[model samples]
Target: MKLASYADGSRDGHLVVVSRDLTQAHYATGIATRLQQVLDDWGFLAPQLEDLAVQLNHGKLRHAFAFEPEKCVAPLPRAYGWAVVDVEGSVRREAGQFQGPHQPLRAPAACEPALAVITGDLAAASDAAAALDALRLLTLAVDWRLDGDLIATHCAPLAVTPDELGEAWGGGRLQARLVALHNGAKLDPRDVAAVPGDALARLARLRALRAGQLAGVSLGALELPLAPGDSLRLDLKSADGQHSLFGAIDLDLAPPPALP
Candidate 1:
């Protein structure tokens, strides 16, 4: 199994898992379960994590899972919650084809890890509270390769929802486009709602947001199976509109060098 994991910044940062062997589709679920084990150990929604595995690339035998940050939060009291992450898995194939659809971050040069999240059942308050305790100590958790005799463990925390979302974007090769603004340009709520065309409307909303004239700014991206963290901000008026996007990756939870 040639697993290259990365953060899909699209849907609040979902985890993306890919395999090189087209014949390995049967193992997709198994791989996803193993990843869930990681999340369970780290202290996210244990029961909820069981239901998150999904197939993203059935042809290439690739699978994906996502964790919703908004929904994965703890009930209360124990403010501990999932925030950061670092996933590391083995690369059974060449790096070129691993992230062929997914690109690596500019800074760290390493293979990405797979995505994992909870599905099936809605995470309950009780589960969320339990998860909160786990999320607190996640920063001190250690990563280990699936090695029988020689295990290579890295001292790092498990990847979070947003980080995994970045992986999903790169792994899926999905594109994003601007949608609409909610409350664009608030003229002290005294003036009329500045309603412009989709393009210009966004520009006005952004200005209002910058000038602190609006309560908040709302922008949407087009695509399905959003990973949570997938986002790109473009300076519509800047000299041709320079754009900048932020995402995350998982390189700490790398599988062992040897494969089964």
Candidate 2:
């Protein structure tokens, strides 16, 4: 079952259950008003939302409307923490080119699964899976800069979950394709990499994650330099290409005003 937070003219958008095909949606007002609320009480709310999802799939719910990606915000707008775990052995192998001016940051040799703590606000997406059991979505990691200085490692602003990808978590490989674009012109594509499950296991041991805190494990190393207006997109597909995840974020020099 796919879930999303959509704009309803409110600061924290309304929660909605999206159909498998991404065509229709039903407001989850009966379950929760916002996505963060549901995450806060996932133990109780997930089952209820799952039940609503079943009802929508069976055509039992009324008031359903067409779903729109453009009318959506990051699934969790604001999270307490955002950390990306690097896949072991995959990082150095995937660092295709060193585009940044400074020496490329390397994962410490002692750190089994190197982790980076993202500071400031991070863009969220309903499509990317936060936990091992969470629904999986494609995540795009953008190399962002502010006033000509690299501010964050990556900014994932948008993500989409497709129904074709069954709810299968753990013990499998996830292939990722990293593409960099400047003014719509494609840059040299990076080496494709497969994220193994052991990396996630290492992260679970290292981070004492709270209920809704997001853990973004990098599938591979990012070696692209993005300037203002440039963008990075990551497309992940299952081995069979049956299920896929995608996300993109444009670079902005001056950070957006923080929300009150």
Number of residue pairs clashing in candidate 1, backbone atoms closer than 3 angstroms, sequence gap of 3 or more or interchain: 49
Tens-digit per-residue lDDT, 1-260, candidate 2:
67766766676667888776667788899889876676666668867988887888777877888876656655555555444554443221121111111112222111111122212211232212333344233344433334434334432323333233444223443444444454467766544543323333334443444444544555444444434333333334344444434323333333334689
Candidate 1: what lDDT?
0.21
Q: Which segments of candidate 2 are over 4 A away from where they belong?
A: 9-11, 87-164, 167-172, 176-207, 221-234, 240-243, 246-260
> Model 1 misses residue 176 by how many Å?
18
Query: All candidates' TM-scores?
Result: 0.16, 0.59
lDDT of 1 by residue, 1-260 (tens): 12222233322222233222212212223323333333434335432332322233344222333422222111111111111122121112111111211221222111112121111111233242232222211111111122222122111112222223232233212122222111222111111011111211222322221110111011121122212233211111111212111121122112234656
Q: Whole-model lDDT, candidate 2?
A: 0.46
Highest TM-score, which number?
A: 2
The local lDDT score (0 to 100) that residue 110 gets in candidate 2 is 12
Measured over all alpha carbons after superposition, the RMSD of each candidate to the real structure, in angstroms, is 23.0, 10.1
